[model samples]
Target: GYHELRHRRVYDRIWIEYHLIFSDDTSLQTSHDISHRIEDQVDHLFRKDEVIITAHLEPESHEPQFASTRDEHERSPLPSREVGP
Candidate 1:
């Protein structure tokens, strides 16, 4: 599960940032290697030096876990009010 994710494109450059969750028993080196593979996959898609992708590794036990969704804010229970039309 991921708590945060961001994607941005400016001009000819692309940027991606997301958090990756791994089992608590995973070693640091293994996690590092996994992140590298993920990065390589992203690099393959962009195939450009201008593109940057950052993946932060975290244990599955991390607190307050939540999945990133397409319309997260829209799904919130809070209601919007308009005044002074």
Candidate 2:
């Protein structure tokens, strides 16, 4: 799971700060790649007017113990649901 630390509109652009939380079993390379993918997706969605100031990757163990107890549904890599008008 990822936490959004900060987000704001600055002039003609948007700035964001993100904290990427991963399980301790995840590798550094995988975390890095995920962050890059997040950044790229945000960039693509916002075009040139958005900036991801930081994407800090940290292990779930470093967070409060309760955070690690999220339900299986919350831990899914990507959950899908139908979109209705």
The top-ranked prediction according to lDDT is: 2
How big is the positional error of residue 37 in model 2, measured in Å on the Cα after superposition? 0.2
Whole-model lDDT values for every prediction: 0.63, 0.68
| Residue runs of model 2 more than 4 Å from their true location after superposition | 48-50, 72-85
**Tens-place lDDT digits, model 1, residues 27-75:** 9999888677666666666665477888888876773344233244223
Residue-wise C-alpha lDDT for candidate 2, range 4-78, written one tens digit per residue: 568898776888787778888999999899777666666665665856567888888887553755453144232
Q: Please report, as a residue range, the 10-residue window in candidate 2 with the lowest summed lDDT.
A: 76-85
Q: What are the C-alpha RMSDs, in order, of all predicted structures?
A: 13.1, 5.3
- Candidate 1: minimum summed lDDT over ten consecutive residues — where? 76-85
Q: Which pairs of residues collide in model 1?
A: none
Candidate 2 backbone clash number: 0
